[model samples]
Target: MALAAFMLLLLPVLQGCAIQVTFDGASIPENVNTASVQLFENRAAYVNPVLSQTFTEGLKDRIINGSRLTLADGTGDVDFSGEITGYDTEPLAIQADAVSTETRLTVRINVRYENFKDPEKSWESSFSAYRDFPSEQNITAIEGELVDEIVEELTENIFNKAFADW
Candidate 1:
């Protein structure tokens, strides 16, 4: 009887408070329900022909899966457009033998985000990510894997910036 009384008291307090949660902890405005992503052009000095399409799709997937936003045909409550700005490889982990043990491949992209509901919340930014592989290994052999991994990270970063208020 005492336990039942206690439960009943707690229920009233809990019911008075509203709680909501999301997998990605996004705080998007309630009015914004749709998003659009333009095809990203690969303008990097080292062009990856598929990168632009891959990134555009990756972001579209992220928005759809991570948030409540629908993919709009043209422009939605929020819009995203960008281009691949840099794709470069550099030697790393030089040894006493004067030989590089690893090569780091970096990808950079410039993104423009617009929130039609609230113009002040809109912004433009650049995001990048990288992967390192053994210098002895040929880039062609690992380029696909590295690019996929880097793109995943880049997409997550961009998603956080746009919706998570990061």
Candidate 2:
């Protein structure tokens, strides 16, 4: 509450100051005709279907809900495509008297953004997330949960990078 009150008090002062943020600087040209996002594919066999569907659908929904860009129903000006290129889990580090105690999950994705209205070159980006935790000697839903969080974060990240101009 104190922090909120302080923020409210400082809102006017902060308004005068430019908010400096950092993000991938992708150029979105003005007068885009339409924007289309293809359904993302899941290629990893070990990947949880829930995580895959949730992340892919969530991202598509976010774009549609948040952007002024129109979907390309065959005539859109811009095109966007994404695919799950990789998903793998492996032991990263061990601890406590040679007991395997750590594992990592890696999710790789490929994104393509293109301007169909002009000869503009497209943007292709690949990003991944990795998480490590105490290995239970057997894979469990814990890993799936971690992957879900990663997907949520990564989707938001990709969304921001692709359009928010953050």
Candidate 3:
């Protein structure tokens, strides 16, 4: 039949145009097989005792779980090293009574990424994320939860910038 002949012809062309996709969206070069993440130091004015450790591990875990790169103690084909540059809280949503109705906690980090396989893609940048809570809430009581959420978001941003190639 004419329709059957047309379908057979199209199938070969379609097969030749098969697309390849990756779930993680990483576009690492074929030669880059390893990565290293140095401990992120806290250099903020008011440092959180555990932020350095928490952020450092979070970044390492993200790379390990999302990419095929092996973890290395020494510098690898891809390297990440940085520090926490800022951690501060500011009042937001001031009311008519001159009182703050909400407050925001912001965290900032500086990252240096080196791609040995493609030096042109290397970059250094700063990333920040923040969370808001009621002004009446004590920072000490909420800092842990807020820091965790902020770190999660910051790590994702850093990971995407470094490997997603977007």
Candidate 4:
């Protein structure tokens, strides 16, 4: 009975825990307090300026609110900046070329991130997204919607890579 009492008392200290980890590298500590997302610039023609702003803002929101990270304007633990490099649409599959029935809207982005805290490490990646719409030479409602959808997807991809560790 005395030995049993001793084991019971030691159980709490001897138990091992199973920790659920999310970060893949460097075990970035929680509340990594400060981030900055600059408005993405795009000089490409036929591109919407508002799209760039939306993507940039979306990324900032994801990191600040979703991951509990703070925001900085000039410098911080992390800095985000990028630009829209390409935006175009083309026929993905044509049927006899009779006013092509399917078109694909694609958006490309080049993103760069710096971890000043770790000068040796930085991340730079490019992500793109495309959506199909009814074929039309001139800009149409369907085409506009498709472009918006592609930009939205591209935005999510950027956010995922930055904060969600995707």
Q: Judged by lDDT, which candidate is best? A: 1
Please report the candidate that would top TM-score against the real structure: 1
Estimate the lDDT of model 3. 0.89
List, residue by residue over 1-166, the lDDT tens digit for candidate 3. 9999999989888666433224778666667889999999999998999999999998888888888778987999999999999999999999899999999999999999999888999999999999999999999998999999999999999989988876
Worst 10 residues of 3 by lDDT: 14-23
lDDT of each residue in 33-113, candidate 4, tens digit only: 677888899756667757777677767766654555678867778888888888777776667755678777778889998
Q: Sorted by TM-score, highest first, which candidate order results?
A: 1, 3, 4, 2
User: Which is the better candidate, 1 or 3, if ranked by TM-score?
Assistant: 1
TM-score (C-alpha, index-matched) for candidate 3 = 0.85
Q: What are the Cα lDDT values of the candidates?
A: 0.91, 0.69, 0.89, 0.70
Superposition error at 45 for model 2 (Å): 5.8
User: Residue-wise lDDT of candidate 2 within 1-166, one digit each (tens)?
Assistant: 9999999999899656532222333344456646766767777666666665776676766666656555666646766677887888877666667766788888888887676756455578987887777787455757667777788777777777766555
Model 4 TM-score relative to the real fold: 0.72
Please write out the lDDT profile of model 1 over residues 1-166, one tens digit for every residue.
Answer: 9999999989888655533235777777767889999999999999988889999999999889998789999899999998999999999999999999999999999999999999999999999899999999999998999998998999999999988789
Model 3: colliding residue pairs: none
Q: What is the lDDT of residue 67 in candidate 1?
A: 87
- As for lDDT, the candidate ahead, 2 or 3, is 3
